[model samples]
Target: MRSLTEQDIRSSFVNCSKGEAKRLAIPRDLDERPWADLDFLGWRDPGAPDRSYLVTERAGRLVGIALRFPSSQRGFLHRSMCSLCLTTHPGNGVSLMTARKAGAAGREGNSVGIYMCTDLACPLYIRGKKVPEAGGRFEETLTTEQQLARMTDNLSAFLDKLHA
Candidate 1:
């Protein structure tokens, strides 16, 4: 992924009002992000832990979406797999992050969700830069590139549901 500017992110939102996008929190440490290793930029709002954001390039344009999850629904009893990266996380490490659909459907309260890394660090986990507390990645015959492609496909499918 390429490094993105604040303006780029604010303008990329597809599911929220322009004013809401303008007011939403943008990460402060943009320069510190591992852009080359990232498939998308995602972060939870510091002030509102239940609210999160994600931005990525799709079909030659940047697409951004706001997401939310039940903060109180922590998974402390068992391990769960992140649908995007296939990494298993124990406890509150995975969440059902949901995004409002784009256009009138979203206005009608339609939304889509997927089980994802709680920290929104699927790329890092897949690349071995971050490790889940439950265990390391499961041994797989696929290479890193294949893994990344799989993750991207998973995300694209979720995005497709939002448009559907």
Candidate 2:
């Protein structure tokens, strides 16, 4: 959970061409992002509503993914837990965040979705964000390791679900 730049996010993409990444229509207000408060960043492509982006730090380097739309949810998204940075959100937040599966997978049009926190605030959810609830999850339990585990588990589950 460190601060990231628009460039950093742009460069982390593994599935898209450098030119495509650079040319991607990024949000103009990059400077106004709550960098210090974000655990990771997620956004949808302006031109392609079906395309999306997510950035996170794994091991020490930054990693990003270009995700495609899920099968198609009519008003409601599927209910699954994110294994990466566990912190469940309403189905509204969970979406099929399949990377435009690269290589042959991409050729085969394979994609995977991630059930993620709607707000994408695993860090805040774990460390506690400015929720108004009096005795919510954060107030009752402030365990860091547990939070990390949930995050990891949520992401793992997401990966597993993609193949299932």
Candidate 3:
């Protein structure tokens, strides 16, 4: 992953209106992000808790999508696995993030959802930069690079669904 500018992020959005993308929050601490450790940049909107965003370089281009999760705490009390990285976390560490599909499908209210790390820190969890309360990552025969490849595959599939 490469460090992204605010303009880069705002212009990368594919699923939302240009005006909405302009108004969406980009992280204030972009300079401090661990860019080398990221497969995608994800963040929840501080002013709108249920809203979130994800941006990544896919197919040789930057693609971004706005996401939303249920605001109520209905599903945050138990351990869950992030579908993208397969990292498990206890309590509110995982969330069901959904993104509206791009183009007319989005206008028709079509969307897709997946269980993901609430903080959008899948790479961190996989690389031991962050630990899950579920007592860390499960022991696996795969190397870090393999794990990263798996995560990227999962993310690409998700992005494909949006563009489908």
Best by lDDT: 1
Candidate 2: lDDT of 53?
A: 73
Q: How close is each model in CA RMSD to the real structure? A: 1.0, 4.7, 1.3
> What TM-score does each of the candidates earn?
0.96, 0.66, 0.95
lDDT of 3 by residue, 1-164 (tens): 99999999999999999999999988999999999999899999999999989999987899999999877664545688899988887776778999999999999999999999888989988988998775357899999999999999999999999989
Local distance difference test, each candidate: 0.92, 0.59, 0.90
lDDT of 1 by residue, 1-164 (tens): 99999999999998999999999999999999999999999999998889999999999899999999988765466778899999988777888999999999999999999999989999999899998886457999999999999999999999889889
- Extract clashing residue pairs from model 1: none
Task: Give per-residue CA lDDT, model 2, range 25-75, as digits (tens).
Answer: 666776766666555666777788677677766667776766766445434
Candidate 2 regions with alpha-carbon error over 4 angstroms: 70-91, 130-142, 152-164
Off by over 4 Å in 3: 74-77
Error at 37, model 2, angstroms: 3.6
Candidate 3 residue pairs in backbone clash: none
Residue 102 lDDT (model 2): 44
Q: Rank the candidates by lDDT, best first.
A: 1, 3, 2
